[model samples]
Target: MLLVLVFSLLATCSTAEEKAPADSTPLRLTDVSTAEAFINSAEVVVVGFFKADEGNGFKEFLAAIEEVKTLPAALCSVKEVWTNYSINSDTITIFRKADLHQENLQLSKIKKLDSDGLVRFLTINDIRYITEYNQASAVGLFQSKVKVHLLLFANRGSTDYKPLKERLGALAPRYSGKMLFVLINGKEKANERALGYFNLKSSDLPRVGIYDGESDKTWLMAPGEISIERVQNFCDSFVTGELQKEKQAGESEAKNEL
Candidate 1:
């Protein structure tokens, strides 16, 4: 299937209050007039330039743009812009234009699904689909015979994220039970609360976690470490050993009574 790439312009400008840090040059948007015209003309516009620094700014920018390519057709109309450096007045801005025709052709190749199926697919893929704050508490994931009640967190930005996702995806076939994968943004308050409970913090932008339903015990799955073989093995050890031991202990009195 052909993949559709949607380009959104992500730009960051530095304000007077926020001084540009030393060693990093400010980025400026030079061609606002042309950019406005381009934005108006194209269905999707991704215009942003990063400093060629040791942090691999250009690589991060390109990866962000690549994400737009996988976006479904419904999201094509939105323009995405991003920049690591604050834009100053004098800095020269460089913009890259994504070919709309090519994007449309790629989009055409993707099979469209109905609303319900799309929602389920997105949820299974660990995409955040919360419409309200309360929905954040909804029970989504499971481990062994127990329901895992925790919000989903995923780091979609990491270059190594795809392999982890693929591994998690395979879990659905092996375990038909409900398994929630919440996409977490560490900066968000809800995510912070969830992570705090587990005494964990992620310096990375995206990460995943599994929370126990009753005790609220949280098990964090590190971003690069998630895989079908690893996850399944972990679940088996936890459930068949720890969880089973607890259950058996709880049932001992009943067995004695019988």
Candidate 2:
């Protein structure tokens, strides 16, 4: 099946005061221009599409969105169709801007009715735009049912990690709720344990690793050019169970030379 890629332009600038914590009330919009601006400025914008005379469920859902501190939150009515990629009653769409490439990972649901339902949707979906892990979040990542596709790096100071990060962002939505793409900074003293456990070194610079949380197994990619295709191949092969068989047969991860 051909994948449909939805791209959205994000606002590059906004007033400082506009950066306040998510409001108790959503940024109500009656048109597309303002809705685009609102979604582009936030990390993850949850748009609640409902008629003005509709039930109170959507209103409650928007209220729950206001309290979700993990991601930037917003909402709009169905009348505003700028973000209506798949519009329907009580349609809640999450527009996530992964990078400067403007490639968005849109996850939408059609039937959620209230604040509790919205919270359940977010929890069940485990939709995170940037899944960065440190010593603090490492255990949780390991315990998750989803596979963790992690990038081990020394620091973000010298190297241009933005491009690689953008690539990961693009791939993340493809896996959506199934995979956890994370970045672990090796320079941090607290993260040394995680680095050592994975047999990684700070001198390795940038490398990719995959952890199977269920089986508690890990596979490392032999250091090479960090490109979107390379990482995508790694993830694709890993998901298909091909990489593990190759690893057991004593083959290199440089590329499946067979």
Best by lDDT: 2
lDDT of each model, Cα atoms only? 0.34, 0.54
Once superposed on the true structure, which residue ranges of model 2 sit more than 4 Å away at CA? Answer: 1-25, 28-70, 74-127, 134-144, 152-154, 251-258
Cα lDDT for residue 64, candidate 2: 65
Clashes of 2: 0
Clashing pairs in 2: none
lDDT of 2 by residue, 1-258 (tens): 001100000111111111355555566766777777877775456666655534556566656676554445555654546444445554555655432122222223334356666665543333344445532234334434454545535355546555666677677767655567776655555555555545666766677777665555667776788777787788788878898888767744333431
Question: How well does candidate 2 match the true structure in TM-score terms?
Answer: 0.53
Query: What is the C-alpha local distance difference test score of candidate 1?
Result: 0.34
In model 1, state the lDDT of residue 113: 25
- In model 1, what is the error at residue 172, expressed in angstroms? 2.9
TM-score of 1: 0.35
lDDT score of residue 76 within candidate 2: 60
